[model samples]
Target: MKRSKSKICSNEHAKFIKQYKSKKLTILFCQLGLLILFICLWEILTQTQVLNVLIFSSPSRIVSTISTLYTSGDLFYHIGITLSETLIGFVLGVGLGTIVAILLWWNESLRKILDPYIVVLNSLPKIALGPIIIIWFGAGMQSIIVMCVLITIVITTLSMLNAFQSVSNTKILLLQSLGASKFTILRKLILPSSLPQFVSVLKIAVGMSWVGSIMGEYLISSAGLGYLIVYGSQVFQLDLVMSSTLILCVLASVMYLFVALLEKIVHRRLGL
Candidate 1:
């Protein structure tokens, strides 16, 4: 009887996988088709000279621009600076956020006491702090990291709080009935269950961190991608602006992929 059930489960799982693959393929085809159509129209317009290349450069022009920047060494230095600031800020934010989340979960009274301060921080506009951050940290990369950290930390806390609180009452009760200690319940239950949401917050904070870093650089900086954009625009170099924008998108996407991978591993391990 057990063998029969196992075979049935295996067959059902195979069917489900096949159906899921078909749906994924359909979505991929639709997205790819739209992308190709848009690029075709863009290339045609540029080649026909119907769209002014000065304002709206061709895809080819952008590609050539990327090629030139690769040879010039300017792109690498700027990219490195921005990436360093972003990664450092992201790590600090996530590390602090997780620590705070666990601390608050361990002590509800402290969480309640700190609620007001959390609200005020969340309400504050990170962009407004750019000038102040530059004054405190100086007008360069460190200031940018500081700015990004501020933007991410509060949001991370909020996200983690929600996740930490999502542990089911029944699960806690079951563990309690099984003679589980508070520390054990927290370590094995609350923390593990919050992994998915923590991953989500990390992804969100990635974009916020990048935005804060770049905006800080924009307000005051001698290097980095945001500085590149400001300098390019001031000099009417739209190509540089577009290139920086593309690089930002890529950076955010890479960060997002890391979060996604973490989420997948956590979910699979927890059978969530």
Candidate 2:
């Protein structure tokens, strides 16, 4: 009787898992179908002259432009430059921001002193500082990276500081009462509790990092997707412009998806 009941329970659990996977697959298919439909409609409209090809630029034209770039051997070169800059900026921004946040969390006096300055910097328009940044870091990749770091760092710091502060006061106090040092409480309790928020910060930082890098490239770059966009516009090659934009969208989506995958892995590891 006991064995029969256990077998029934196991079968039900298996059925539940199968259903869950089927639902996820359906959602994935729907998303891909929607994208395909949009692309087809876009192509159809442009081919029929309903939408001006010069202005809207059909998917086929964009594909042709991409092919030209590929044949010219510039496609991967530009992509590699932009990707490397973005990854570097993303890492530096997130790492430095988190370290600053931890320091702020550790020292209340320092946090108070710097709070207003941090807020002011965050509120100030980062783009307004572009000319100065170029002058300071020159027209190279360094300036572009600095711009990316500037865009993402403040947001990461603020988000992470909030996450650290949001850990339950009661839990913190209990740990203190149990004679745990400040570092122990932070290491064992606060950091673990803030993992979800860190993931959220990563999502936000990904977009910011891309924006910063592209904007920097717009200001001063000889080779990058942003430079291609600028050059295409100058030459009135709308196809090239559209193709670069499409590539940017694809690259950004891939980066975001990577962060999402990391989030899933973290959640699973923590049983969250």
Candidate 3:
């Protein structure tokens, strides 16, 4: 009887895996098809002058502009600079935000004291702080990183804190009744239970970090994709602007997909 039950479970699991793989392939193909269709339509419209090539810029023209930048050796430098700042800011913002959230979760009084300030900061426009950041850290990488950090940190902290707090009080109380220390309860129950929210916050932080980095570059930068956009607009080089914007979109999409991949890995490990 036990052997039969085990075999039944195995078959069910195999069937589920087959279905999952089929759905995944379907989604991937659909996404690729939609992107190709959009590009084709864009090129057609531009060729027909329905969309002005000078302003909207065709896919082919954007590709040509990207090639020009690559041949001139400016593409990688700008991308590298922006990429580095965004990544550093992302790491620091998420790290520090998580740490602060843990501390707040551990201390109720401290959480109460800081909660209002966190809300206010999260609601404030990060761009308004650009001039102040420049004053504090100067028109360099330091200022750019600071901008990214500021943008992501508050959101991260609040998100994580809420996740921690939302863990069942009954679970916490049951653990306490079992003589579990606060630290042990956190380690065994709270943190583990908060994994889903942690992944969610990371997804949010990924986009915030990019926005912060680009906005900072817009404010003051000798080099970076954001600088390219600003310069292209000023000189009416629409192709350059379109190309830079396209690259930005691609990079941001890549970052978001990376976070999504991480979410799947974490979910699987936690058996969610």
Candidate 4:
């Protein structure tokens, strides 16, 4: 009996380890394949001169350009400023947007009253607000933050409000039948049910937050990935343009991963 139990335990452990190894190997292979394909395409194009080395830039040239920038340590400051703007704007927008959502959820009458205003605000191109924000706040971090908030908050608020209100009717009724208070119903039923939607909206808001920050940099103010791209383009420094773009993509991907991790944690905790 003891030998049989030990054998079963060893087999289960081996199977789990094998599964884990396979997953890691799959991820590694995919990354390796993509890297190989990208390098091959770059080398082929450069060899053929079909891709202008100076214009499109070979991968080797871009690496050299990155090394030069890294040695100068100039990219750190630009990256810091842009990341600060993006993170702050994202936090403010999502926080305020959530508050707005909760408030709207609390009062259906208020939501109905403000419905048209919400439509108008959402329909108004957030980019159009850039000039006004600049005029109101006068060209700096404040205007940029405002633009980011303007873009992300309204949409988040609308989505969360709808999601909260759309919680399962049966769930709400069951809570009511248990003589639960409104707060109890919301706390146990509505809020929990709306979490999946919140996670999705958070992902969307993160993208919008990046958009707002970049647009702000594009329209006004001095430093950011967007500014670097514009500056690089004007001077025809394709390497700098490419580097800044890579930085933006990396930053956005990190933020995306963060939200994804949060979603996974939520699912695990809720047993979803």
| TM-scores for candidates 1 onward, in order | 0.84, 0.87, 0.86, 0.84
lDDT of 4 by residue, 50-168 (tens): 99877887777777877887788867878888889888988899889988988888888988899899999999998987888999998998888899999999989989888998887
Clashing pairs in 3: none
Best by lDDT: 2
Error of 4 at 44 (Å): 4.2
Q: Which stretches of candidate 3 lie over 4 Å from their true place?
A: 1-31
Q: Which candidate achieves the best TM-score against the true structure? A: 2
Clash count per candidate: 0, 0, 0, 0
lDDT of 1 by residue, 175-219 (tens): 999999999998889887787888889889988888888888889
Error of 3 at 50 (Å): 3.8
lDDT for residue 254 in candidate 2, whole number 0-100: 100
Model 3, range 1-272, lDDT digits (tens) per residue?
A: 33323333577887887787799999999999999999999999999999988888889999999999999999999999999999999999999999999999999999999888988898999999999999999999999999999998999999998999999999999999999999999999998899999999999999999999999999999899999999999888899999999999999999999889999999999888
lDDT of 4 at 24: 95
Candidate 2: regions farther than 4 A off: 1-30
- Please report, in order, the local distance difference test score of every candidate based on alpha carbons: 0.85, 0.94, 0.93, 0.87
Global lDDT of model 4: 0.87
Over 1-272, each residue of candidate 2 has an lDDT whose tens digit, in order, gives 33323233577887887787799999999999999999999999999999999889889999999999999999999999999989999999999999999999999999999999999999998999999999999999999999999999999999999999999999999999999999999999988899988998999999999999899999999999999999989988899899999999999999999999999998999898
Output the worst ten-in-a-row residue range by lDDT, candidate 2.
Answer: 1-10
